[model samples]
Target: MNRKIELLAPGGDVDAIKAAIIAGANAVYCGLETFNARNRAANLTFDDLLGVISLAHRYQCEVFLTMNVVILENEIPTLVKLLNQLVNTGIDGIIVQDLALFHLVNKHFPSLLIHASTQLTTHNEGQIGFLAKVGATRVNLSREMNLAEIKSLTRYAHDLDVLTEVFVHGALCIAFSGQCYSSSVSVGNSGNRGRCSQACRDEYDITAAGNKFPLNLKDNSAYFDLPELVDAGVDSLKIEGRIKGAQYVHTVVDSWRKQIDKFVESGKLLSDDSNLYKVFNRDFTNSFLKGNLTKDMFIDNPRDNSFKHANDKSNAISVVQIQEAQQTLSSDKDAIVSLVADKVSQLSIEKISLSLHFSGKLNEPLTITAVTKDTTVEIQSAVTLTLATDSRIDEAAIVKRFKSLKQSEFELLPFNFDGLESDLSIPFSQLTQMKNQLLFKLTKREYIGAVTLPALTHYPKLNTQPTLSLLICDEKDVDLCDVTDADIYFKLPESFKVNDNKYIDIFLRNPRLIPWFPAVLIGKDYLESVRLLETVKPKRIVSNNTGVAFIATNMGIEWIAGPFLNTTNSYALLTLQERLNCAGAFISNEINRNQIKNIARPKNFKMLYSIYHPILMMTSRQCFFQQTVGCNKPSIEDGCMLKCEKATTITNVKGISFAVDKQKGGYPSIYNHEQFLNIDAVEDLSHLFDEFFIDLTDIGSGSKAKIDKVELVSHFENVLKGITESKTSLKQLVTISTNAQYQQGL
Candidate 1:
């Protein structure tokens, strides 16, 4: 942004809001009760939001409410209620992830600005442009981007009249935003739904490599990149810690504020007091900023909820100022009491009354009584009355005389002052002295009330025996499925979604097979696609998103949780099995071998682990092929369907090629360049998981060379049969693929 850069901080609660303000941030982003990415944080209610907006406005700061979560069909009405109440609150904007929420807010509450959440996985201009067309005022770039990628997107956004916001400090996710499935697969709770278990923070034990703590990524700190980010035309510099305590928020905000000011004046970073505000960071990494895969982004010791310590030393912040915030918390009866008190104190107000009186005699007395809300102050004044030589006081004059409550405890209200004679002589100067008596009493602070949140958890156990699942794209690939050994699932293409019979016809020619539903048939696509698929009534299915899971459950069909559901932990898997009533679920491709063992399964359901497959890196309605070769599709729903039949391999600066394939509804699902392979450790993980899936979409995805479908299937069968190959022979067939930090960790 060419204008003054806005410093955005997190307001997890009212205390954090105040701390951000006191710490000198230009804007604060917070969640209201529900539907936010960090639902575990102490969110504000409808009433709390009114006071929050009022307080933030009072301090000349903006408040952007978080509506960043995948919308469940049942939660729409509640979301509408929240949006309606938010309209009148004069909230600066909203941070959202769901497309439904974005559309609803844009259509109904035109006054409210929308800032797309990073959970939307916005990386490039095409995605950001898609959001801008939907009325996003700003887009939070994905944390997985390099500086070059960010510069390009920011530049593109500037042309579209959209602002760019990037995280300058925060806990970085190992998976791309909107793509990580580790939490959901493990616990049925979703990162997209704001209940992320942060499985990336967990330790992993790789079978082949000696890397013990593989997935724990170092937190991101682009602090020194302040000037460059500002120069990169970012409209806002953000700090990400809504789940943190107030002192941490204050410390981070204060440090960034000072550094920003220093950058503006000196155009250089601070080296001297660097350790003063060490930011409680777990060793920082700018991995995506430079495409440095060799960088040490993994953490040896991951921080948990129990890790509670704010200051590193006195050098962290100015001593006197830090104590003021500390003392406010210390004054409370206990730790919990202090937290609740801070939330309530945010909207606290003083109670008071104002009175005016007059005697029948012209010079008798004109009395005023002022009392505080608590009755702590009772001031009675009978000022010296002046004799009126000409005109006497009228109703209007009386109202004016006592209405001057500047610096008073009580708010002004309309009251009848006709009991006594208003036609009396009184010096206005006498009224001035009366107000001075109640100054101290009016200046005391008070609070509104504390908001409560409910406890949350996922399901327990459910498991099924192993069934070799094969994911295919065409009718020819379906013929290769050996009915005697494996269960086949064909991913329905965008063209076949409305009429699965085309693929069903092809499948019936060979053998009856399960249908793999689209990963992103959201909104109308969800309703229509589910309607058509129900007619086919396939015995078994693959559930892509939560909506599909609901649809499948309603029809009483057996479903296996697909890779898109993001099942990484045992809790997430338990959630999917018991909550969604799923027969089986796939373990997240994001986790290593030992992490899979941690998710102890239940007896009723089966778990499928992918030993070989191209990991889907990103998914979107904006097709890459359409973007590359011009498509005149007026909206996301049209024009690009047939264009996406041919897969395009997009190569980045680092020569990493991402395979882009479009599923039903013209949505592009991008896969990583290298395939994931762990053949040697296959037999070892067999006890933990039952079904082993090999997603064969890679067969048709156009690359320099294509693998024979028969060979890939046979390779899996051979490994399953306990057959071993030489080290050199294994790499030639499977070992030479990327594990997506299955060893290095993201």
Candidate 2:
């Protein structure tokens, strides 16, 4: 049998947690005061987190802690400390998005179950497989995935032993997960770092010739469906509300509980349940889950007009009838009675007086009077009529009798028609009088199912284990060693100039930089014409970028990058090859582990174990200068400001600013000043370059401006190297840079 799907609920506060547990939820996801996606939600403190976990555990419900926000370099250390505290507190699992944090958790707490948060934009099978490989046990599938897409993903994940969870209810987002720019564009806040201001929910207008077109005002309601998603069959059903109130959570949970139970009992899913609309629903449309939604789905009109109509009372009446009856003492002489009426109104009846005349051998017209409210309505005739004493009758009979009462057209009451059951017994006369009274008091008591105790799973005391893997490499010049059974190659330029030879200086400074050389050679060179290289003799030469390679017939020069320069070629051919090599070489912004992989296919690349800091990104354009208007010194805490001509803005989160360049195809550009000086971990390249080179001419530097900035960069690079060298399992890496220099004069 397939595993039973768990119902995951949201708990913004303690009350919401209680409501979720009481309403048959199997698990609850919550956030703490810091580092959660819902930072604005009144999140739990450290004590509250521990308390919630303990309480949820007692009830046999799993509690998932959300630490799913993007962290800046300076935030990493604090986050690591918080993660350490949480691991000690015995959290069941953690939701994460940041790759560095993921690495940190895997290194420090390998046994901890990691869930890929929805903000990661994990839409396809390839992304899921990648995440699973990196120790993500479960992936919260993107909200935009349709039924067919979900099924396809589930099938693909099953083979890999990864679980797929999908959101089955709650508010829907207009943008794709992790792809939203509304927050930054509208409010200068980064949504990826948990500071969204919900700009999508705001109203907007399109205008032409001074005439405004209200794009979202047709039906006067938001159009997203929550009910249809429940039938999609996810491994876990998630309700999305961390900032919503407890009442909203309770109402939605209760409705879904009843709906799920009804579906299970009847073996059919009902779509037109009007009760669902009462539970805080918008105009329902299956957004993207069915297909690309229509323009109607974008309607953002308020439901104010519908509120007036909602207050309008319906004049329709509900009528129920008694179909059969039998005596408890006599089963053979059973009498079947039916009650009929035209309308039912809102009125209470203390006693239902039934007038019944029995036709029998008594020779006297006998009227049977029965009290329908307190005692069983029995006919008092000499010839007795048997009644059905089925336990299902008492409840049903009251409902049927009350429903058959008629009222004036203006006195209509909203009745729960489905609440009436089919099996009921009532005296023929009492059923007739019940039409006049809307409310009936029955002698029988209402029976609600007893709450069964949940079987609790005993979670063992968590034993924190070290989670980092250690790799060691020795520094050795393999090129200078024996060339036995080795294919040697060198990447060389066709011509050289001493005046303009920075690329040559960098290459000569670190000839054994395994990954950097490969990356520079693989891509098309952006700037190669200015630099020149002299002819070099080698057995085989390869060219990369726009530069050419040269090889002599006898010399053993192995070209590691760019197009191949054969030994059969002459001197002029070698010069042409060098120029061709320049076409494919360009410098990368910042080098990371992933970039290293892209560079060289080494069996085992050595990492620099001891270093001060690391740089995160490199750009041809100056990001901080663009944000600060005219490059004024701004205080570090005040953040950098970039004013754009093409309606673009940048939000600086944790020292990194995400600039949406409207002039540059709206591609997101990440800018950080500290990433340039970090030393990459390598086994045998210490002999050549003593420091990483950073060109800061674009920022128009001075001692006051460049010193502090470079110092911060150097610190991060060294710290990264130190962590690697110490072989200590690191939970996080943080880089700090202040806007103090920019704020100094202000």
Candidate 3:
């Protein structure tokens, strides 16, 4: 049996969701109040999400939650908690973008379904293969693909046993997926973070030689063509208006529903009698689906108003006129006139006969007997008047009198005449032709025009002036200089000792550090332990994942740890002055460059650089192993064992299981040990006297594990030489240290 194509619709609010479901949608993708792509939609809360899940499941429809935004370092805890809650609520699947988040979820909640977000911009076969390797079940193809490309992609993906989904109808974005920079450049907000301000929709002017050109509107209409992306082979059809109103939702859903049904019933897509334009539409086009989209596809034009007032107002008018030529009418002659109107209603002819009287001989009017046309109507008392001119009588006076009578009201003069023709049709073909031509030209022009920026300068007449500010910061506090110049200091414990039997005491102190000063201190004992035990630095260094957590708490490094330091054991004390200084420095640099400034802090510490493996998802807690149990099972497929879920486990020498979930829709997990050897140096550790601690979180898993097996005293000599040769910059050191500490929860 052939599976019916899935119809997916947007549910910005409850009503829209209900409407879509009633209209026969197979699935609905929506966002929760947090971490959803649509930040502006009065999105569903946790309760609402649960409710929606129940409702959709009741209808045998699947509900997919969108947690597609990039996860920030600080937001990991909240995200993890949310994921746990969502899993417990029986949500069918999640759509996500950040790889780290993907890994985290796959590691912790492996049973949950993961769908790769379109924002990943997977366009080619290589990208698809990559996603497949990472365990992505379905890939939402980018809207920019043409029909042939989609067909090729679908075929390729099908061969790999991966499901492919495509967008069929909705608001079309002007930029390529994952490649749009318009929002960030215009508003200092990244669309990847769900903070886009829709700068693309604003009106702009294209200026050359100081003359501004209107790029958005031409001939009083928007130029962009809304695409309808249906094809016979598409697995799912998605609509794109999550921010639109319910009316728009209803109309679009209804129209597309009809189209899909008709296609299913008859294998025909478009209908000549369909009222597709009655829904919310800008000029309709096939987009790049057919091939290279022409200039006409981008044309912005005036909106059609046919759907505004649900009525037809076109009416017709009639005009009647009489013409005559020189000829004397015979006594049997009668006059008739025909009037034609275009599609007229309530039409009636009040009178249709003519009368004539003659006065030539005795100053008395001579009554006519009859008037007929096509020998049909006879006027018995009219015009027995003949065209013969009496030689004795005055012809001019009679003619003049007849003309006066004819002109008096609705009368016709007795005159010499020719044959008459009636029932002429009105000409409306010219008007119809003109209207169609105008519409076509306008649509074409909009697609060909380039986008422009709008002018928003203040006018003096309006009594308004634009205000702007310039800011600057000092360099010393921004970690641009060496640690000493920034007035930040670090000290290790007098004696660092590490052994498997005893907990190491590697104290970190920053007595002169000011409050809020950004600094990191990695104890030699903890670093050496990770280096020897894990062999590779953990991808993230936080209290939850490291031995440094207890050490940082005992040493009290919280104050000077600034924002990046996650451990509470090893603390750096900071003064209020240093905090202000760092902030000032960051602001000063931004002001100089005319860019948005970032806050600053202390200079030296340990740093980790990503080497060979991709950083999957970042999280506040360690949950990957717990989520892998149910995910790693093999399913019987075609008499072969196939991994149905994205879970993989690597056992350590100690026989501890480490879960690796490489699913596409969830957080991505990094592997291989090559990424850990890039660390260059450790700063502010000269006091340790030729002994610098190496943190394994800065290296690959295998490397960290290798480091764990060797004692610092035995390998110290070669490690020191390797560190010096690495040419690690102060920034790189700090980056690795901060990331390591964060992962360790230090």
Candidate 4:
């Protein structure tokens, strides 16, 4: 028989867990108080987790513990202890974001299944294959993927014996998951670490009338796409909210449960998502799953809005909302829970075959034998039944007594005393006692299965005294970067000429030149360009995608990972080196300076110190300019207006400015308020980085027009020399950024 798709639910607290089980979820995934991505949620304690596991198991459901945070080096000791303690807690699987969890868990407790979190930023088959080879049983594909992408990925992952999971409902991030850094830049708190300030929900001036929420993508509800996803062989469908209250969770889960059941039976989704919208939602966008690359995915005029208020900006929910929702759940909880219990109590799975030996004589004791799938449990009552004068214990009466197992978790298979009289007298109280003993013995055993993990063979080495480099966006900007005393790192934009050799001559002269690939490539065009550029054999290759890592590994070309791959924790950094064949990496810019310090890998491991490029707030396949001006294409050549070349500014109501810079390719990336200039602070961490790079893609000092080649080269040259010489005291230094606290986090 084909296994049905697992109905998974989110459990933020004990109440949510119970509600999910009651709502008919086959499995529940939740986080504990420590080492989870939802650190801000009311996560469970050890005792709470134990209770949750026991409760879910009692109802024939599984519990998966969340350890999806990118762990720091210092946190490893605590994590080790936590995993060891959780070994016997009846946790069926571990949902993780860090590679170290794979290493540590596989080394010690090999029985648990590892799930790769969405934070890992895996989009391609290469990334998914790497995780599966390293021991990921299931990989949660990125929510940004279209249906075609999901189908292709699911097919590939299935070949490798890995299950695939996707998010089907709830809020969607404007930026890609794990690739966003707006929170870190705006609030000095990292979203990857679960302290997001919801910077995307902030209002930005998209029109002259008012500042609208342009960066906020509409919440996704792929209810109608369930059939297609099932056809694609998806193993699980996950709902997005964990911080939401129990009533919201219960309603959502119940709705999805009914919808899925109906679809499975009839091959179509049931109508009515009214309860879904009433509870909470941002209208709905099936764009990602539909592969609909259009601007309508966001809330435009605000008239047809799905949700009126900002329910996402803060996870610290209102007291009234919580109390109100709690009441709704309280009134309905008993009915829902009773329905679940009745359904569970009727399952024949809890039944065990029983063989009995009944003594017909007066003083002989009765022995009952019970057999579970793997074990045998036998019990005998201490009290003996006395023979009666007028009556005998009938087979029908004995079977009735044995079959009355309403309160027990086990059922005894039909059995008869072959040689006994139809009316043999027996003590009724003694018979009841024997039945109780049999129930306890058969239902209380835990799984004693052992899991073996593959041997780990790769280790990373650190590179000390890292050098300084520059990111040149175009050939025109190459001259500006050439005069600098640092190693020139050319950034191949997503919109490079398909068959041009104009930039090859520039890098050919400098063997030390490192070429940085765009974090995102539109379609396969730029990637094809990179394939053509490979004839030049770039000495130091920089990749942000694992597909590039695979090419580099096969060609024996040395490459380093960029943060677009989401290497927030040390384990991710190590995974790049050991598994992805990357030499070293640029730590995620989302992390604070303290996290960077504690994330020291092997000594001398190359860690990039990027002195703030135009920090990409978010990127999209559809350009907003084209959306407003009337165009169907994101590229300029496809009958589009060149809105990016003109003055395009979106300021928040608070008067903060954002520069919209659209690329020639389909990708349109939004830059932060100012050029991330953190010169003064780099001095403190100078020993940590062997190389520091200045980003000259968007601005020169303050404005885009003020880009003077000579001034930039001279200013950085002085800063680079003055760190050691101390005498260069920089005659032409730009003023230190006043908002240093935002850039230099503690």
Candidate 5:
């Protein structure tokens, strides 16, 4: 508390932004209707965002814009145009998820501060190093981390001069952020694209635990854990409610504001937190931060729990008492709304008003006095004005040249030309220079002209024919590697024993099996993985986790970025190859043919694609069986990750089902019912790739496929080898497959 901790609030709209500012928020983050994660929220327009930044700065509150969604190939031009305009807005920072943005901002727009979004799934120390290397000044830690984990990562980040922020109050996601594909697979709406359908909250058939909404978790509230977070050395305490209305934002931000103030002032905590309950929430829990993954963290209902909390707090047992409690809660909510409205009524986000007064003589320089209510700036043309008849500085020409000022924070009023004599002219270039100078003086920042990124050189494939690769996890399938000449990738588990040498011995014995790391690794698990990497000293490996990639890059080992890193645009490819020394990468399967066709590959870097694999819906550190088939353990234990091998299907009310599979030493994950088999990519874009990979592992199969693994590999290889008859045989072999994602790109 003694340290200056920032209180960051969410601004879904103009009112919410004003409410947070009036409620004593130190910073506010919001989106601008496009290229942000909260597309469902009432995001601000570009013009409104300019005014919001101006207003927030007046109150000493910083504004951070959210451009956190993955950028597609076609959107880069428009995104660059927006960035050019944003560099002059005095925005404090830009929160981003795409690696392409990091590369773009670091190389072209270095003046813009970059904050890594939670979608990056930053959990381990090496991931912090990775973010810092990629130019993130601050990082949003994954919500699943505990106090000790946070403290350790924060210390590491601080050593690198990077700040850390924690999500103290918000809705909790069961799956790790950026790793969830449940919405994308269930519907065409992808969470990565900010079109999540809330599949976790959908009604499902009752499980053995008698729960209908099993995947729903209680909202996260670390209100009482301020002291511990302070001890953890986090720089900011972020509140997540961009989807909530202005009233919710005001009430929650105000309550936390008072709590933070009291704690900072007296080092004593506030006990009453009833104000937070008056808003929308699914009850509240701090179990994740406590490192206790109990079943109680989940709520059977996903709606607002305020009414129930009130009735329980009032000890209402009878119907009349319950009715009275409900009435009181409604009245209190109304009172809060009225109070917030009154407080925010004093705030305004209107554009700055400007009045221009032009005065000049026949021989002196043409001077334009820019006047505002707060200040005035007088700028003159460099050259002396001269008498002219055909081209004079008239009101029509001057207004046309200065109209662009209205696009920014200033609104130009009617121009005044009475003091200036007619038939006096200056060069058009001089007029533009005066306008630029005036902008610099008014905004207190130098004007940045538009920048154009040079087009990357398109490298052609050295080998025209793409190679075939297969992925396998179990040692039983290792014998299949001898049958084909394709490269084999060995899948590693999410958890590792303290001194486990089982994987080390496997890699040492079979030099051809390349290690494939998963997307999520924390604390000891991450360290053990690093130990294996150092012990084996593999020539090459494929990694989905940035933490693992950072270690590999530091050790001078060749690494290929996995598809989960969400490589979509060309700049992301450049970031991996140029910055991280990555030798190869897999383009994301979330995009379609048109979106994939425009990406220019870097020289000497290989582009890989997955033509056949089971579609992963989500992965979680929490137990999925507790509310499904019913586990005897009250919570997940250390042994669960190394011992649990449970697989079950959860059917929704719409009659669609998804398979939940948990292998030993692996986190529980959900998979789409049908496997992904994109034969069209092979037929259409085979020339653009160097490798077409397939997962022959039984991780998500769950007794679905009866075909022999060896025969399936042969069929896929033959299809890739241009065997006319093998296409039909391959389709028949994998009957329950779809290529819908390839057709419906994000």
Candidate 6:
């Protein structure tokens, strides 16, 4: 028997949600006003979400709410309150990015289903195990994954009873999701906090290749890839346009719905995708899904390409033909809008009208009845009513007690008390029991009591004076190990030769150099990394990748969570320490001073922070040189990861320049114009951290002159020693530096 594949749609507003349901969406993912990734979308309110859930469920469509942002320490209380309310709202699942949410939902609110967000960058097999251990029931695979990779990962996930979702349509990010900090460093709008300014879509100075928007990629459309995805065992096909409107949602969902039904009924696919091009797009591409990274994936323009596509497909060379194409597109869009509006008009999400009746007689049991459009619930008090002068149950008392029903998905109408005797008395406890029963019958949800987490005990620092640490990539900087006693972490690239012992020898030769793992490691590279860990057997390592951390834990080797893991709150600390047995973790730099100060560390767990480093904006598997400097090769090959060395700068129209840098064995990456230097954190947050790190790796320099690694280590050490004069000297040494992130945090 073939399993049914779910068609998930985005709902940025109430109308869009209704449109999706009417167009045959199996599930719709929507966000409330706060804590969702698409902050630009017109999100729903709490009351609106209740109605949406009720309405979607009525059509057999599940609703998943997105709380997919990193949580700050102070926001934990509010987040908990929201979770408590969500438990009784009949929400199907919650899509989350923060590890703190995983801990809270697993420990306190086990009833809420947890789905891992794409922001976690889940690509490798070990990451599936890690997410499963953290209590995720479903995981949205990274959009960059190919069909083969998705199949293998999905198989592994299924072994643990976890489902997988893939982005079948919508806009694509140039960089890996959640890993990009371009908006955060440039505008103080952290994507982790749902405030992305979309720096990737900004118009830049024309590159050598003569492209204006070098980083903008064509929108993703997998309309013809349904069979392949189903064979790959993907559970849900997710459309990625939460910031889009109802017209776009209706057109895309309607198209996919027909396609899916056709394929399922007779194993035949719909040949036409014209309805898709009638909506907003930057054209379309399936290169990423096909495992081909080429220059054609990029689009010079970032606006809607519907009219342009129509004109080009018609081969319109004359102005009249172009105008005709535009008019046709306009007409098509309006037709879709009208069609969707009519279909959704037949549906309603209004609050259900509720009526209440009270009836009783002397020496008889008191009875209360509740009526709604769909349900009728009646409950009799165990105790009989008695005639009384004081403390009688009047209309005012009944109104006050049952008015709380407004909190549910019901609007209270006038009470029907004509059947009851006036001023009859019964125990208030009986009334409370009757009200609870009415709520249970009407909502069909058990009342889950709220959970209040106890405060985390603050642990004292093990070292009174935090030591300085340095990260180095090149072998030439190995001499710095002699200059400072601080821990020198050797940087590992994202790719490596299969069964190669090059890195293993490097680690064996230098035992004092702790291995530092990068965030992304896929396929053979991940296996090679595991082989290196098994061979070298280092005492300790710093890992930005959870896949490596999972293997390290299995080997009983102590692992320190790197900065890319995005640890922000106390529950996040508990997750690392308790679940993964992580020895320590680096607090995320994306947060502000106040947010950082409130984090409580687990007992005997080390905390670290980077005080000086180049700020990475974004990283991508696609070749940056192809779009910027015009590569001779048509597409990126495996050799490019181990042999390419390129650097260039692209200035935006706003006069802000970003450096695109690619190392010999790393992915093509973009860096901020200025390096991040937070000297004030040494004095302000020194006591909370055990080590302050400095990135001595000579990456992300772009066109700037390189700084001496020895001088960097010396100055950082002096500052850690409480030398105020060295702070000024260090700032002078690194002329292009900014601490804006420390001041204006997420």
- The number of the candidate with the highest lDDT is 5
- Computed on alpha carbons, the lDDT of every model, listed in order, comes to 0.62, 0.41, 0.39, 0.65, 0.92, 0.90
My TM-score estimates for the predictions, one after another, are 0.50, 0.44, 0.42, 0.74, 0.98, 0.96
lDDT of 1 by residue, 92-133 (tens): 899987656554655466777989888766654445555666
Q: For candidate 6, lDDT tens digit of each residue in 687-722?
A: 799999999887997544587878878888989888
Order the candidates by TM-score, highest first — what do you get?
5, 6, 4, 1, 2, 3
Better of 3 and 5 by TM-score: 5
Clashes within 3 Å, all models in order: 29, 77, 104, 20, 0, 0
Better of 3 and 6 by TM-score: 6
Candidate 3 lDDT tens digits, 58-122 = 67777888887655544555776676566555577788765545455554666677777777655
> Mind giving the per-residue lDDT tens digits that candidate 5 earns over 517-629?
99999888999999999999999999999999999999999999999998898889988888899999999999899999989889998999999899999999888899999
Lowest lDDT 10-mer window, candidate 4? 726-735
Q: Flag the better candidate by lDDT, 2 or 6.
A: 6
Per-residue CA lDDT of model 4 for 694-730, tens digit only, reads 6766532223344565666566655655543321332
Ten residues in a row with the worst lDDT in model 6?
701-710
List ranges where model 3 is wrong by over 4 Å.
Answer: 206-232, 270-276, 301-746
- Candidate 5's C-alpha lDDT? 0.92
Best by TM-score: 5
lDDT, residue 436, model 2: 26
Q: How many backbone clashes does candidate 1 have?
A: 29
